[model samples]
Target: MIIHVDAHIAYRFEEPTDFLLQMEAAAIPEQALSGPGLTTSASEHEAHISGEDAIGTRAWLRCEGDFTADYRITADIDRHLVDLDALNQLPPHQLPGATVPYLFDSRYCPADRFQSFVEAEFGELSGGARINAMVQWVADNFSYVPGSSNATTTALDSFVERQGICRDYAHVVCTMARASAIPARFVSCYAPDVTPQDFHAVAEVFLADKTGEPGSGAWHLVDATRMATAGEIVKIGVGRDAADVSFLTSYGIAQMQDKRISVTRG
Candidate 1:
């Protein structure tokens, strides 16, 4: 599948502010990108940097007064879909260095706190089966309330409230997977099928490869909200939590003036 994305963001900066923006779809092995690239009103102060694990690109910018950014991209997704249940969960000792970090707690996803819950609720299951069940539980029990959560909401909060947007669902899934001794990370992405047509978030779990080799594993995407199909997601980047992959992170105060995002199938 191919996806076309166009986004325009405008903001009012109270003073000179330094910002890190990760909006463009990642140029990973699974997704190929062909486009002119990001444009901004304050191009002089903009520079590009690599995203976490080098999965995508981020922009560093300094601006005052008013700022606007325009980005458009065409992404050809070549990701192969597989059965999550068929994949094995490798032991923590066998995990690669990069995957080990995802097994612990993070700010928005406190895996430590959910250990008991996960054990009681999903103790009977293991590997991808447990992950599948966890995702289903989230889908069945939660309500998709757009403004039900805020920037500070965590997975524990969402679990208790049983309502939130995609980000919250992702946090819950990540937390649960980590609690189950499965490595999981948060993903920032774009999906054409998402209602309201905004940025999307999902969870990526590290599992043993099809061959079930001891130290060979791969990351598989999972969406608890069911808004993003496995093969259709165009990832922006990944991090331990949303804080590391925010579309816009300002070092100083900034207010949103206007923002519009459109993603469609091409």
Candidate 2:
């Protein structure tokens, strides 16, 4: 599979500002299953202007690879591994899942509120069945709604609202898994064939007891936002939460009044 992605972010400031700085993690890294063919980043910075000014930032990334790899699985849950190739390929700065202490933001701590929901849903099933059940539940109940929430939005907020984009959905799922004592993380990336959106979010749970191989269990992708199942390929940013791997940023006193993203795949 091969994919091309374009992301654009624009902000309008209320008054002239001296400086702006932003950290971007929109570029997807190559892994064992996929290869990054070509990738590029471009930004436009401006100085003090009139009452209203605008700043635009864009990123273009191209990737290509076979959809199936040596580690690809068909249906069985016991064949999962950590895909060490993928881990070794990542840059030092981006390696957080196995090394970082907290993938989610501190503000979102205290996950007691969401633990009960996970236990009730999967308590009767085996570990593998429990994960599958949770994934199915997310797919059945949520609907993707972009521009519905932002970084400050909490999992409780998402659960109550019942409507949000991928990030919100991923946060909700991450919270549930953590509450269940399952080590889970947030992932940000693009779904090339699904939609023309610049950014997307999914949750990866470490199903240690599901693989039947003892400590050999691997991370499984769960798309809470789109409610997608396993076997789908999507570029991803794995972290503790949305704050750990945000796709866009703004420096100075600018406000992002409007933003849009479109993605396409073949």
Best-fitting candidate, scored by lDDT: 1
lDDT of 2 at 56: 17
Candidate 2 residue 188 Cα shift, in angstroms, is: 0.6
Error (Å) of candidate 2 at residue 138 is 2.5
The lDDT for every candidate, in the order shown, is 0.92, 0.49
In model 1, the clashing pairs are none
Residue 109 deviation, candidate 2, in Å?
A: 6.0
lDDT per residue (tens digit) for residues 133-231 in model 1: 999999999999999999999999999999999999999999999999899999999898888888899999988888877889889999988988978
Q: What stretches of model 2 exceed 4 Å from their correct place?
A: 12-106, 193-196, 209-214, 227-232, 257-260
Alpha-carbon TM-score of each model against the true structure: 0.98, 0.62
lDDT of 1: 0.92
Model 1: weakest 10-residue lDDT segment is 36-45
